[model samples]
Target chain A: MSRTLFFTSLLYRSTTEHKRAIAEFCSNVKMCRLTEQVVFSDPYKISQYNRWTAPYLDEDAEAVRQDNDLKLEIAELKAKFCERAQALLHGDLHTSSVMVTRDSTRVIDPEFAFYGPMGFDIGAFLANLILAFFAQNGHSNGEDDRKAFKRYICQTIEETWSLFEQKFIALWNEHRDGSGEAYLPGIYNNPKVLQLAQKKYMADLFHDSLGFGAAKMIRRIVGVAHVEDFESISDPGKRAACERKALDFAKLLLKNRRSFVQIGGVVRAMRQVEE
Target chain B: MSRTLFFTSLLYRSTTEHKRAIAEFCSNVKMCRLTEQVVFSDPYKISQYNRWTAPYLDEDAEAVRQDNDLKLEIAELKAKFCERAQALLHGDLHTSSVMVTRDSTRVIDPEFAFYGPMGFDIGAFLANLILAFFAQNGHSNGEDDRKAFKRYICQTIEETWSLFEQKFIALWNEHRDGSGEAYLPGIYNNPKVLQLAQKKYMADLFHDSLGFGAAKMIRRIVGVAHVEDFESISDPGKRAACERKALDFAKLLLKNRRSFVQIGGVVRAMRQVEE
Candidate 1:
């Protein structure tokens, strides 16, 4: 997902051409408003479509509605989601959106694609992966506990973020002298200043990813649409328990995402919530 | 100018209507990109179009180019100017863009109008008033020092900001139950939470206006177009002295805009720069 976004970020409007072409590309799709309503808005409020494992998760869903701090954080994210056209995005990158084999990986269903924050796509993939990890307990039996599988998911989460950060920075360095309008070569060409800019850019992106990831997680659990990972659990009790863990961690992450400096902290927190 | 923006903010896309209409209106105009280039980007860099009172402001213009902190701050403002579609802006709201009489005030020449941060328009008007205040000395002779008129200009700057804040918030309170997408009625209906949300929104807008205002001032002096307030001075030395003061204050405001909480403090700072 990060690799996909790396290529997307490279496709910017050239300084010589008409900027309206790119601006129209972003606005014409209406993807920003769509994401704002579904991923950021409808979930937190009393929307007619919102549902969860009724009775089991009813209180949890109501609690989300009542949480003012969470609502405040979500509003900020919603504004950023609507405003920041950082790069082209997959728009709806979740577990089912990808096809993977032993050697190759392909992403599908880019109908929602538009120019938006790169973290949105990255966060969507991570959120689905975390949901899958939590749902493993429901699939576990006496013969197969799925403990090792959960650990593998955790490792994959960490690796995906680490690799994404490395590749994204490498691409930026490669294109430092390019025609990107955000950072001009004449001003940011100095190595020290370039480093400062990159540090600030990456830090902001990391927090955005975490915050969006948590929002995705919360919506799946208590919002209009439930993920198949939790739905496939069959037993409502077990499913609700797994969802509650994910929900707890997501709320914590969304409220205090800035306190998290790295991906490792997030994975460890996920583990702590599972216990 | 603020009253113009208050009305502009009222025109928003209804949730039931096609958002594409408003989105296209913004992108088609390409006002955001134009402002980003002229007001935010061109002034900070060595553009061919850029000019100043040559020989006199040679070092000052060079210092503007060399200030790494100023460049960094400008980059953030450029990104915001390009991204945040907060409301419909007058776009180029400098003093010349307005027509005023004893009985009526009318804003003209909205050719650059589009959906953007409200601060850009507010800042443009305020920046022009500040420039007019600074250029008063150059316009003065022994008999008419223009001291009273200078104070009047400062008073206008202060009143414009104060009135804008009050009227804008009053409109928000009146429309608390409206279809505005930024603050949902369900989530922000509580008096305490609504107050918090308004405070945060206004504060952010205030800082954004100051940053954009400072950028507008800098470009007028050092970028492609020079404001007539200074240009009308005729004597290059007098014009340069007035410009240098405006430029210095603009740089300070741009870099430290967040530290300012009220318009009164800003007016005081402007007077201090005159001394």
Candidate 2:
């Protein structure tokens, strides 16, 4: 993201050596210990921390606990989350991690930073925006109805993925000759072959992002944590309504991520999700 | 696996509480630093250590170095080998690591042990057997002449996977109620759903084993290390023939591993790969 680059620019200049300083920083084990339970384990199984509107989502929660296929998929994702060290990721890149002003952008609160899939960061931000979209119903008022805000959040999600794809391909083209370990310039020098490889890589990243993003949304609704979008709703019943939609959407995304090839498809699906 | 049980039995008897000891072991970094060149990097690029039946297979080796798709596939496999920690793998599980006595079977030389894909071990063993199969053409004499020996090696490869599948599924069926974190008894308790889950897991494991096995085979023939299968042949031209067939077979297997649904398919392919 441009914001990440802006922040990286500041840090890049501050460093004594401009060398791409690659170090395997030890993950905060306590945080991993906690997240492993909340994100991967607890939500699928019954746990004390899990909560929803009583009587309203009791059966829904029970349904989740009993879903065999869902649990099986989650098991695979959990193993990937715990085991795969794909890249150095911004572990907690929710909308809260970013700030945007007229002329400035910044990323903050990366204390949860560790090696992970790039999608973890992308998914966190997109999933949170989606939460805002769903919660718009609860946030509506007489004068400042959030119908427009809901549309804006969807727009942001759509733009984020489209621009990311265009820019990512452009950057790969620019650096096709550089010393990138994933794709060698000498081997992938042909335009046609390179394009195919890029398509596959980006699709993989998209799926990962969707899966991680769904996990993030699920945790916010039912696990140890709750997001501000749903938390801010005054009426518990209304809050649960918004949270339930988000949870349903998250579960669908986590299970059916590969079915999506385009971000617009996901955005359309987000719009179609019943309130 | 028996050796693992033997070790686990020793450790289990030592303590009552066997913990889920999950640590992202700082991969034997030195070992990785060494293998990256020999297995992944040096063979693709340039290195003094690389040699074949030079002047005989010189063009074949050059073709490998110049092949774009081959390098692309290698890059992916290399990344997976370096990054994905699917399980606690025997890092260097060539035929050399396995030992067989009259009444005792043991796996030795685990100095390079760390967490990795189960396929790495399976692939190593299978690839080495294939190598032995290819080397049969060179190992001929007036004696046994390896006709039955070749059949025996292929049989071993087939039984290794078939027996592994049978025993693995049976164990899963028996311990479907046990405290395995990968699949919970509460959710995947039923037979139909459990069978479906087992099928998917085994298929994935088979593909990984094939891919990793192919990588191991390629590295042995074309990289710095030469297997005794080819090295034992006194005739350089004859050795080149054996090595080339092995290398060609490895390439096909690595790129098209997913097409194989069963080990018998691979064995049949092995039988087809002529001397």
Candidate 3:
């Protein structure tokens, strides 16, 4: 089957093998009559990221280093999560994967999607938010505009998680009975059993989500294709200052991700600044 | 030799042994001899990080997923840099490290010091500046003050590198003759070779500085102790916004550290808001 892989050049570089695996997996998931088809899985064709064509998007040298570091971190997290729970993963998901048109918000590229862990998808989206903020900084011409942009991005991340969680729970609750019995049968039977199972599942998701989110956030800093917010600074010293800010955020996010249950906790953590 | 180790509550429990080795090596450098003499290098004083001392900082459950991902990424970066540079490093060195009681700036707190890579120290200090900016969202008390603080941090990182390069070179220039050949029948000549050797040595230093700096920046954000900038938002959505800004910075710093040479490159980099 022809399969496509979608990834951010700034964050990931996939091999032919990686792309094929994702394509094959997506094909399996799409063919699974038991799972819901609301989220369509399709292999997207990708054009090479030609540095010459994208002049302004030149990979900042420092940003590349940040990306390299970030990639290693993501690999570690993935290994840890795999060891903890053998859940399948969506592989990658974020604004880069989503497409918005007037009234619809659709999940587009599923090339990197797989059955690794549910939390991975959630974290990917959230991590992109951190990426987006810096990306926008280059375009934020005024202080007020920059502040507004910052607020918007933060709010979006919080809302996205809230929305995703609520939606996921709603699906789980609705499919509790024999309606969609093909995939999950006695999994949701008996109230007490269901409660215990659900809690454990949720807990797993929480831990995985936190870990995955951190990986995504930290990789951008030290991985190969560092973000523009710090790179575009034209002055090495100023860029270094910008990088320091990003590092602080990475520290806090990884440290506190587990404790943050409500959206407010996440918000509180993000608002912190270095003293 | 008597050695002392202090512990930080990092995600990964670090037992610094090689750090002692590096410290010993640095101590042996006659030109840069330490005033605080260590009588012995006993392994008994090695301290372990108290992993359970703090509560899970992620107050918001949803954000946990994102933070966890960041944690992995940070870990990876630190590992890569330490592995590549031959970890015998002075862990932390920033504006704070330059203890300025009056007009003089003296380096302090080699307590966190270990043998990793020289870049880790330089990068850690520089990365903190960007941390201050994003952390300003939560960590900084006032908006205007945060702005000023950010500016100062950025400037300091720039100046630190510039001054450091000059000082490092000056030190090499003055001390390379090996005590002027004891009984000099002619003018001393070894010093010139020592000075010449510095060029090659300094090039390696520059590379390490960039890589370690990238690691330092990523760890602060995604490691166990999350920064306050993103933590203080009270709204998960808002907080993530601040985090995004920080991540952007990390990406840039890590990517460009290698290519940049002078303070000017760093300053220009920090000033850039976008790609």
Question: In TM-score terms, which candidate is top?
Answer: 1
Error of 1 at B93 (Å): 0.8
Ranking by DockQ: 1, 2, 3
- Model 1 clash pairs are none
| Candidate with better TM-score, 1 vs 3 | 1
lDDT of 1 by residue, A1-275 (tens): 54556554522334223234335555444555666777887877888878898899999998988888888888788767665566677789898998999999888987787656778888888999999898888888845579899999999999988998888888778877876667777767578777877787788889989989999999999887789989998899989999999999999999999999889999999988887
Better of 1 and 3 by lDDT: 1
Write one digit per residue (lDDT tens) for candidate 2, span B1-275: 52342232211221111112213344355665466567766666666888778898778877877776777677667656655555556677788887889998787877666545567777888899999998888777846678999999999999988987787676666656654555655556567767777787889889988988888888887788978878989988778888888888998998899999999999999878853
Runs with alpha carbons beyond 4 Å of true place in candidate 1: A1-11, A15-34, A137-146, B1-11, B15-18, B26-34, B139-146, B234-238
Candidate whose lDDT is highest = 1
Cα RMSD of all models vs. native, in order, equals 3.1, 5.0, 23.5
lDDT of 3 by residue, A1-275 (tens): 00111121101222222223322343433322111111110000011311211223233323322332333333334333321112234455655667789998667655544434456667767777765664444444536577777788878877876666565555555555533211122222345544554455455566666666665555555433344555566655444444455555665665555676666576566656421
RMSD of 1: 3.1
RMSD of 2: 5.0
Q: What is the descending TM-score order?
A: 1, 2, 3
TM-score of predicted chain B, candidate 3: 0.56
Candidate 2 Cα misplacement greater than 4 A, ranges: A1-27, A141-147, A165-180, A184-186, A189-194, A234-241, B2-27, B54-59, B140-145, B165-181, B184-195
| Candidate 3 residue-wise lDDT at A220 | 52
Which ten contiguous residues of candidate 3 chain A have the minimum total lDDT?
Answer: A36-45
Error of 3 at B264 (Å): 61
